[model samples]
Target: MIKVKVSLRPIVSKINLPTVVKTTILPGDSIESLFIATQVGEIFYIGNGGIRTFLDIRPRIIKLGGSSGGYDERGLLGLAFHPEFYYNGLFYLHYSVAGTQGPVAFSESFKPNPCDPKTLNQRWINRETQYDHIDTVEEWSLQSNGQPQKRRTLLNLRRPFLNHNGVNSLNFSPETGKLVLTTGDGGAAYDPFNLSQDNMEIAGKIIEMDVVKNTFINNPPVVTRFNELPAPIQETLTVMAKGVRNIPGISFQRFYNQYIKYVGNVGQDLVESIFSFVHYKPIPVTQLVQASLMNSEPNQEGFVNFGWRGWEGGFPTSTKGGCSENPTLDEKTIAYYNEAVNTSVSRLKPLTSYFHKDQRPDKFGGTALTGVQAYMGNGIPDLTGSVVFSDLARVEESRSPVRGVLAYTRVRTDGKLNDFSVIETDYNFGSQSAYYVSLGTNLDQTKLYLGVYGSMKVTDCNQGTVFEIVP
Candidate 1:
């Protein structure tokens, strides 16, 4: 059996409003690099492989909105090394820029020149620079060995919303030399026009493209929907999957044929879930909503639809759902109800979900199943192939007796979701909090390095800290 332990370290502390967090060991090198996307700055790179330190890279300022360059939710939000990182000094990044305009028409979206003054958005009228953003993914040149390189945008994104601009989680499927990216819904809140569910637009979809060839998986129709172009712009972009909301972390199984796990942070109202999208299935099926619920009585059977606006984490001030005589007034609640009833039409659900402290924290979010896998491909002592997750404690808010600790379950190779193991981290792990745990290769390698970053207010402080769980 593969034994795993957690190690806690304060890589960085008191850093408020941290976004995308990614970890990658240098290719063919032992240097581990942790990339963090923040709102205050562009991107921050921290190394803990051979040494321990943090490095920040602020890219050249690009005009946003339609004029001069500025920052908002628009900054470097994603970072990834090319599959052949050793060969191509090329790496990819995604950032939003101004100097651009939109709603011009959807089909001919990418046509407006970000530099054109007349084409800028009305919001950029006074900026003297472009108001629209030119978000792109570029390839960079790395130094000899696996050192950081000078970046160049390979693909640019011109998203509608300033927030939910989306981050790129790149993974190379060896089975197919395709690079897969799971992007969040195009905006921070609800997508009214359904840019995410729209098959034509690339804004809110999980896309699959050939990084080796730098092209789309399938050719899509060319027609402008929200751009100023007289005609549609010809483009080659493919959408492999659709309907996802705010996913920052995605990892492929170490075993070639296993499933790909997606750890995402959802917006308020809905529950955040860890999705295991199996690649080899006839249709990639996943499990959602696994957390348990607490009962007011010994056996009270009731259902609580998380009211995003009315009640956050179950306090009930009348924000999200059916609180007033009319529940439809709550936009999020209406959206949730419409979605849940239309399961046939919706692909969104939480394999595991949790309730607020009032509802019950002891039942769900107590523990979840997770793990590190050691594929038997090359045939080594494969000790890393197993399930592991965090155990929940009532540190932050313990309403009733702890029914069960947070337990992360795993679906075995037979495609059965079963209870695996639980981890006890002496922390509250407040509502919707998640941990990104890495079980390194072996003893000679590193065992497990678990770190967490998310919104956790309510304490004396207004912000939260990113911490490593020490075993």
Candidate 2:
């Protein structure tokens, strides 16, 4: 990797935490405009040299940061414009619904132990009253008068934890022309119930929905699994992949005629990984349901898996503790030996994996992966045709004035793991903490955007800034 340096041009400042930042052409507009979706259910766009509120659904969003000590992962997490938005004025949104929070699924934190079979095979029972919150997907259209209105409800999902709901979760696939939704494993540590690998669970899978085929259901049932959905609604969905721990979002980079899909899976105490693939076979929800009812396995020959709850990036999932005798050293134990062996051959290898604790002088330790985008822009010549990503914050001993990290990596032709280089930026934040919360690109991938927050708490309002990655 080559050394790259860029400048952050501030677009807007003093706003709420942004979850999604992308460009789309508004109805009757001649050029594309940058749209920013905040975690508190507000969408703003920059047009005619000023920021304007495009939509506000705060009344409909669940109360955020109440149970998590002011830090939250469930709010307005997704926003996507239809491919024909300029003419059709259609768009989609994914967010946690109001008045739907429930009791925690478990009384205590979860950790898997290989010696105890019961701990390894815990089940999520009494789901109706034992969950964290409900997230809803909706379709909205821009009216002729330029205001956005809700068109229909697409799907409602039940999450089991307060975190790992996935940030920037909604996107449109350029190849198949379908809306893609990437979800995290129902969020206790180590996926206590193994939801990611289960074919019936919807928490940790990548699904595609055909919005063109309306199911005519105004109020869809809130469910946790594939078989519980209405038949008509199930017919419009297909599962693309599973075994996800948590994801920032998915990106599609055009390569000749096909698009190379890029996904960043946030790691659990080990390594942050980025996976790329150009081919996959998505299984329809109807087929999965039929197979479940018959007690048979669906054809998973061409399906994709990220190998969660077993393997974390390039290493088998393990627990770490300090060595009693040798105080300077740490002890590691494999968390799930059988699961690692079972998924070893089926999971896709990541293109690149960065460690949580790196000793190399050239590399920095990563905390959590927040965003990933492919930059095809010529403004930063060295970063053209490369995949760029953002970390919430680097791992360091000091806590004050925390700063995030930016890095870039490329796909290799030999299908081997590649290394990345840090991208230094020219910006002065003084003594304020800056956490990179989100990343986005234009429709053509010719421009890049970065969302930075001054604090980690979503309740700390008016502490965000949107910046353009410029040369």
Candidate 3:
């Protein structure tokens, strides 16, 4: 057993369900500022040597949940920066709103009251049926002072329910120059609506969109809405990659001549997995589909389905069935299993599996595996090419190696995962469960940020925390 030593430093505590900490550089700045977001709809930053509010959409968030909603899985979820941020003062955000709005047009004054309790705090609650309808991707341009000024609505996801509606792993790869969208299997247990396997639905999928060529000139940052996009782009965005329960952890690695994108998809009852795709170029979805179509291929083959309801740790016998919304469509696993390994298709397999039971006998930890990043910095050579990530779970502070927060593994050239180890095991992150964890950036990409989502995995206005991990 290889023992790993690390440290977790406190950057800011008492955050309100901190989901992600994003960093970007501006011109004439000695260092980049870190933008932190809470599930309650607040965006703040540590820049210009001071902490300030970058943007706040709390007033507009529908069904804005807190502990009262039993630890809502929604709210302001992820953020990103333009590649040329120093040149263009722009960034992007992903947040959920009441589907009751039903993918409406963007309005400058469209703020509406949501899940009214007249106030927000620890005791907040909203029904999955009540608050979640449409989750959106938005672009914002900053004023000269580094605060957001204007907003543009990009992709609008008119979702099915609230649970798992939180979008994450929002990233801008300098290599691809496009925004990668990570969505969950459209809420409810077992992907109730079958959104994950729907070719036109954007749930439980990995989607990419071009940001340079698609927006309004006066508005600044470009966008391609889900409905308005070309067929190829839309098809690329949704291939019905059934079985992707919810992919939260995602990061990119560009080695000598290969660009590897790593993702950790969380399973419902048993399996937790990490998989990678070698996407060197920002390939058009249309082309991949066109080629497959020209060759007469099944969409399932090209996309990997990790078997959400169909397969689990104890899959064959003790498997959980499909979601409640459409049970008949997912009745049994005969066709599902055949679809997963269908020979005519180009199915992707997991590098390794973290079975709930021992997570494959060599797995490090279990449950709520949120995000993964392949160590790309030279500061830590041993960690290079290794996948580093955090989990979402509440554990006894005394349980070392984190009862369920952070861990890492190495990927051999053959795509097999090496030994897994817990990071910062000696440190106590919080009694709260981690809703999300991601890599952070400084002058160098040498640290990771753990956003303690708070107890019960919900955002408690006063209980959430954000911690910084260092070598």
Best candidate, TM-score-wise?
Answer: 2
- lDDT per residue for candidate 2 within 1-471, as digits (tens), equals 899998999999999998999999887788889999999999999989999999999999999999889988899999999999998999999999999999978879887666667988999999999999999999999999988999999999998888888889999999999999999997979898999999999999999999999899978998999999999999999999999999999999998898889999999988999999989999999999999999999999889999997989778898764224565667777887889999999999999989899999989999999999998888889998889999989888866689999999989888888999999998999899999999999999999999999999988999999999898
lDDT of 3 by residue, 262-282 (tens): 777776655577776774223
Instruction: Tell me which of candidates 1 and 3 scores higher on lDDT.
Output: 3
Query: How many clashes does the backbone of model 3 have?
Result: 13
Residues 285-330, model 1: lDDT tens digits = 1110011112122211221122222222222221243335674574
What TM-score does each of the candidates earn? 0.58, 0.98, 0.76
In candidate 1, how many clashes are counted? 68
- Per-candidate RMSD, Å: 13.0, 1.5, 9.2
Candidate 2 positional error at 163, Å: 0.8
What TM-score does model 3 achieve against the real structure?
Answer: 0.76
Candidate 1 residues lying further than 4 Å off, grouped into runs, are: 1-7, 12-73, 98-134, 145-152, 214-237, 263-267, 280-350, 356-358, 361-407, 412-423, 427-470
Task: Tell me, by lDDT, which candidate is best.
Answer: 2
